[model samples]
Target: MGKPFTVSRETIVLAPPEAVRGLLDDFHAWRAWSPWEDLDPDMERTYSGPDSGVGARYAWDGNKRAGRGTMELTGVQPHRVDVAVAFEKPFPSRSRVEFVLTPQEGETHVEWFMRGELGLVQQAFALVKPMDELMGPDLERGLANLKAQAETEAGSVA
Candidate 1:
């Protein structure tokens, strides 16, 4: 095992914190903003446990880039949602994902954070592209897409 990787990304969205939190609370809502959703057009997805909140779970098996993994929401807060992620195929690993929301005046500040130990395969890949370099773009893209979707959802409600 190599040094663990920690990647955190923050984005200001033109929506309420609760609204942004809602987006993270539901796995189904992720299809609208999750960066990996498009990685495999034929990805098989399964939703189990609660519909949303702490117990919500999502699993997917997809193409090479998509791989296979399962994520379960383990904690929930008015402004934070924590997820436990585990990969079974392509690589077997685990990670802790946290989404924090903060309301500013009228807009919401959103931060997506992930931390995990590097598996042997990941350690090798990290040599080619550091974790931040590899996952940062995806996180940024996901946040950007989330911002657009949250703002759009906010607009529709108004």
Candidate 2:
């Protein structure tokens, strides 16, 4: 056991909340924007439960870099999505991830948040490379990719 921690990143996507939510609500659509999607080109993935929204599940196992993890969509609303994530390899940890979308003008403000308790191993690792240092870039990149994809799709539909 270790201390609790939170890491968050936000970006403005030039699209409506619904558009951004579409990409987030479906695990399959994550391939278009998820930062870790390319970590291991041959990563094995499985999807179960509903196609999207609450109850949807996505599991992945890959090379050392990709590790192994599972994500379940625990809750979904018009402007927010909550996911339960568990990593079993490379580390063993569980986190609550949230995506909050707020409409501003015609665009959407997207905030990605992750909060969890670090394991003893992770706490030690944090001393060398903090959680923010490790996850901030990935969060930023994912949000940037999400913004680009959402804007492109929104523009095409306009």
Candidate 3:
């Protein structure tokens, strides 16, 4: 463990808490809005373990942009979902990802966070480009996409 690094971003979705929570619980749901989904058109995906909750998992392998990684839902709740993220290609590292929801009057506030301890290699890389700057834009884009998806899902039923 070198230093703790966290990338956090939030967006308000025009959907109820339950509706938004559904997106976080189901790994496949991510395909609709995950920013990286476009990085590799031929990215291969495997869904395993449980369907869409605590034991749910998602793994993928693709070109350099997509790399290779596996994400497992370690803890889940209506308001929060915790995921264990591991990258095996390009580099190897583990991190904790979380989705937190707070309901507003008619919408839900969703916050996505990734926390990890930067290894020596990462620390060195950070010297050139900080982790937050490198990851922040993607995080922001992901949240925006998530918001759009949630709103669309909510509208479809209305």
lDDT per residue for candidate 1 within 16-76, as digits (tens), equals: 9988988999999999999999999999999999999989999999999999999999999
RMSD of 1: 1.7
Q: Mind giving the per-residue lDDT tens digits that candidate 3 earns over 43-130?
A: 9999999889999989999999889999999999879989999999879999999999999998998999999988999999999999
Task: Please give the RMSD to the true structure for each candidate, in Å.
Answer: 1.7, 1.5, 1.6
TM-score for candidate 2: 0.97
Judge candidate 3 against the unseen true structure and give its global Cα lDDT, from 0 to 1. 0.90
Question: Model 3: how far is 90 from its true place, Å?
Answer: 1.0
Q: What's the TM-score of each model vs. the native?
A: 0.95, 0.97, 0.96
Clashing pairs in 1: none
Clashing pairs in 2: none
* Candidate 2 lDDT over residue span 30-132, tens digit each: 9999999999999999999999999999999999999999999999999999999999998889999999999999989999999999988899899999999
Candidate 1 residue spans exceeding 4 A from truth: 156-158
Task: Arrange candidates by TM-score, descending.
Answer: 2, 3, 1
